[model samples]
Target chain A: MNRFDYIRPGSVAEAVAAASEPGAAYLAGGTNLLDLMKIGVAAPDKVIDITRLPGLDRIDWLEDASVRIGAMVRNAELARNTAFSAAFPAISEALLSGASPQLRNAATVGGNLMQETRCAYFQDPLSRCNRRAPGSGCDALEGHNRSHAVLGWTPSCIATHPSDFCVPLAALGAIVEIEGPDGSREIDLAALHELPGSESAGGIALKHGEMITALRLPAEATSFAGHSRYLKLRERTSFAFALVSAAAMLSMEQGTITEARIALGAVAARPWHATDAETFLKGKKAEAEVFAEAAGIALKEASPSGDNAFKITLATRVLTRALTLAAKGTPDRVPALPASVFMSSEGATANA
Target chain B: MTLSISLSVNGESLNVPLEDTRTTLLDLLREHIGLTGTKKGCDRGQCGACTVLLDGKRINACLTLAASVDGTDVTTIEGLAQGDTLHPVQAAFIEHDGFQCGYCTTGQIMSAVGLLSEGDAGADPERIREGMSGNICRCAAYPGITAAVLDAERRQSESEGTSV
Candidate 1:
């Protein structure tokens, strides 16, 4: 880790002011930031500890029936909250599917949203990464690009966001509340992460000193609680990042899909929200064929950035499986393995 | 610049001065406080060898900054025993031979205690394995580790039942 000055701000305003400096970074859970620093990827001179900041660790049910999740709420806490989990099970599953129990206990929602990519090239300081160093050139393009992005990727960068929590949030249309030097504002979670463009390194859209305060899930988001699922394909059943993941939510009436939301992860720079597929699923019958078609529509535009053509097919299958599970109706509780594709919906050992 | 902070480690409170702000809780314990039980395996979040209870919640101490956890209670592997008596998880681990090299035992034990307190994973072996996935025993003591956690869970529940 780099030698730096630690500043614990007492309030959000104070934290914003302290982090507004050029070489300062806000510290929430420190799971990602600290690791990045250890690898010499991020070297902030000033560390603004915002863990002590007040009024940012709450889970509020607003009068409008929307739920506002404070950014500082730990991932494990939110995943275990009965009310929150019952209302938004996909989000809970996504949260539980990420990292490990120890990490989830310390990682905060805000920090999850702000986590950097897990690309080996990005983490290796010796490698040439345009995201790590602008215009330095991307070594991932020619190197082991098996895990590179297949959607919303450009020549500048092909690294995918490594956040499982944001996948369901993007599908559910969650709104992010931001606080910065210019005051507070809100944006869709889908818009929070920027896609790699010719002139962009492709990370978060937040300007300097801007911090995510809370995430709001609208009242309608809870409507799909009965038919929501997140499915992840990974090398292991636990303690692994997603190879290809999908969040599928549906509101069905008499075996017919009334509304649907789909988002794919690890295939794009951001959670690839399948708006076209979502539009195509409305009023369609809740069937495997329909789900397969919807999955096809979702990945229609996806192309292999490098040697990841298999990921395009894998991502399509993951989405189809997620939608199929969503149509089966969400289990009474989250599976023991959370979103692992190998686990049964009931989390039974017989299947394992 | 040096900073002063207070922490309650293993039921003992102490006011410690930190000369470096970048010191992690793992380093603070092993280097400053001289509690070497919490081994530093990966020195990153990837390995759970530095697992500790922060305010009764299990977290990777290597990823946790010492200054950020000021005024918080931390419990390490050294804190699990009651004088001569071992903690239920520790006892069960010994009974089941949950460790081969024993380097990851401290973290596995602490993580097990936290998992039991969380009450999410029950006596189910698969759930126990999933809950304890963070602690990587390179010796591949997973079967024994799972059995130990299951036995500990049963023992704790039985004790509670009899006490009640």
Candidate 2:
């Protein structure tokens, strides 16, 4: 890691003030920032350690029935909270399915949202990556990019955001609270990550000194607690990033779906919320054919960016399986392996 | 710039002066404090060879900055055993032959201890396997590792007069 002056700010205001200067970076969970620094991708002259900041590690229940989670709340703690998990089961499942237990314990909510992409080209300083250095040309475009983005991608950048927690949050329309040099503001979680345009590179939308303070889920987000599931496809059974993943949440009346929310991950620069498919599923019977049709609609606009044309088909199957599992209702307990597809069918339906 | 920080490591409180703020907790323990029990397989967060307990939670030490953990309690593999008697998880690993090259043993043992305390995974072999996935044993000693975690869980539960 590059040598730098370390500043441990006692308050959010102080932290922002220190980070507002040039060559300053806010350090939350060092899992991503330290790695980037070690690889010479990010070399900040000043490191503002915000891990000790007060009033940022809480999970507050609001009077409006919404929940406000502090940015410093660890991923492991949020997933294990009984009340939080029961109300937002899919979110908890998504959190548990990400990274490893140790990473989850140290990683924070804000850090996860701000983590850089896992593109090999972006991590390798020798490779030409436009995201890392604008106008450098992307090596992943013609190189081995079997996992590159298929949606909302441009030739300038084709890296996909590798966050499982963001998939369910995007599906539920979560809101992010931000604090910066100017003031505090809020934005929809979907708007926090920008898509690569034809001219500009894609990345987090936060300004130079802005930082995420907390995340909020509206009261109605809990309505799908009865039927919500997050399913991920990976090469390994655990401790791996997703090849394709989906979060399916539905509110049913008797045997018909009243409301539906679906989001796909690892397929785009941002979480791909299938709003059209969600609209089509309303008032329809929760059946395999209906889910298959919805899955087709979800991938209608997805085209291969490289040698990963199979991702479109694989994404469709993963979404169909996720919707099928959601229709069966969430299991009483999160599967032992979390969101892995290998979870026994019998165990999934036993709670229904 | 040098930063003076105080840390409680393995039951001992020490005031260590850091010459560089870029030092990671893994290097602080291994190089500065002379605690070589923790290994560094991958300096990045991908591997769990540098696992340690920070305030009773298992975290990757390599990714954690030494200056950031100023007042925290850290328990490393060196702290697991009391005198000559090994920790339950350590003893079970030996009984079950839970390793081949034994390079990843410290991290696997530390992660298992953290998993047991979390109480999320009980005596189920599948849960144990999932919980310990962070620590990769390249020797493919997963079967024995899973058996060891299960045995340790059962033994601890039995001693506590609880049914697994």
Candidate topping lDDT: 2
CA error at residue B152 for candidate 2, angstroms:
0.8
- All DockQ scores: 0.86, 0.72
Instruction: State every prediction's TM-score relative to the real structure.
Output: 0.98, 0.98
For residues A186-245, could you state the per-residue lDDT of candidate 2 as single tens digits? 999999999999978789999999999999999999999999999999888799999999
lDDT of each: 0.92, 0.93
The model with the greatest DockQ is 1
Clashing pairs in 2: none
Q: How accurate is candidate 1 locally (lDDT)?
A: 0.92
Candidate 2 yields a Cα-based lDDT of 0.93
Query: What TM-score should be assigned to candidate 1?
Result: 0.98
Model 1, span B67-138: residue lDDT tens:
988999999999999999999999999999999999999999999999999988877777788899898999
